[model samples]
Target: MREAAEPRRVARVILLDPEDRILLLHGHEPDDPTTTWWFTPGGGLEGEESREEAALRELAEETGITEVELGPVLWRRYCSFPFAGRRWDQDEWYYLARTTQTATAPAGLTELEQRSVAGLRWWTSAELSAARETVYPDRLAELLQRLLDEGPPSVPLVLAPEIV
Candidate 1:
């Protein structure tokens, strides 16, 4: 058995536009650009900031979308993966947010993000389902469609570990 790494607490936003398309960031591992995936906009909490605060801050910094209506935590996940030469164990909270901003101009990005992030795009559930590329939190298309059909769940859904 392998040793368990300390979990890094992270807050991620599932940003949706009025058109219902979800925003996602396309990025790759810094150490291996060939390995890529599309993921939500969010990052780890800074200082004593709450997950909600971190979600908003990260969203603005990554996508320049600050004017948003932050919704509830829709999902939670414990994922472990390797990137940029280090292994990450992340306990993440996925919050739902709506924004009118369609275009993105990054306000701020850390060195790591600057290197890892490739682009940002809005994805319809159909596009996600048809995509040949990878998307984090597997089954995201199905999950998203579920959320669209039925509003946010009364309780946050606990997702299975994504170990890779």
Candidate 2:
């Protein structure tokens, strides 16, 4: 049996607008521009930062919006994927946050993000469901719809794992 790679803990935010659209960042591999995908704002936790702290810090750094309120963890997932030049095993937590601000001026992107990230866009559930473009963690539309309709679970839900 193959041993699993150690997973890196990452904190992500499900940033919602007043219209309920979720914000996603578009990016592509540096070695393969044709390989593109959309994902939420997030990064690996540094040092001993709590999940909430990492989420908030990532949100502000990636989106340049600091006025939002961080809410509870809505979902968690274990995902393994190839990015940049390496495979990553990521244990990611999704936190809910709402913001009235629309403009994003990402000032703190890492060098990798600066090169790979194209831009950010707000997506509606319907748009996400119908999109032909790739989005990570598979069924993002369904997840967003469930969250919208049912609200956050009393306890954090473990989302289905993804390997891609």
Candidate 3:
């Protein structure tokens, strides 16, 4: 069971490759709540901006991944909870970003400066799978496997997470 959403905003990306890596950022968990061991590079969507634009802006600002093809909405979760006695609502949206060049981002980003994320490394699917306990785990991995068996397709993915 899940609780109702709180009042907050957030946007994110799921940059992937034919090989198993997806762009990710490492960060220290909040001390008080102890949440967020690590998180992808993203921020809140400004008013009147569409989700796609917000996502693109966030990736560019955080990971220097501007000018890439942003795909359809791949995953969306409206979650809220209390941690360290503070209520928070996180409406996160994930997208598939395809690019020919690698990405660049700041390093040594701290929780403050909020934009302090400075990670510029590629993480393999195996790494993501291994960190499922902390980071997001979605069917995109299975989709990657499928694409491996059959070369990348020219279709849009209306995906929902796989459950066992």
Model 1 spans > 4 angstroms off? 1-5
- Top lDDT hit: 1
TM-score of each model, in listed order: 0.95, 0.94, 0.65
The best candidate by TM-score is 1
Per-residue alpha-carbon lDDT of candidate 1 for residues 17-109, written as tens digits (9 for 90 to 100): 999999999999876778889999999989999999999999999999988999999999999988888888899999999989888998698
Q: List model 3 lDDT by residue over 29-139, tens digit each.
A: 244323344456666778989778888887776766665787765556655545444665666776667766574755323345243332346777566455554544354
Candidate 2 vs. true structure, TM-score: 0.94
Can you give the lDDT of residue 43 in candidate 2?
A: 86
Per-model lDDT: 0.94, 0.91, 0.59
Cα miss at 141, model 2 (Å)? 0.4
Q: Give every collision pair in model 1.
A: none
lDDT of 2 by residue, 58-112 (tens): 9889999888978999989999888888998999999999999989999999999
| Candidate 3 stretches greater than 4 Å from native | 1-6, 18-20, 30-36, 81-85, 107-120, 137-164
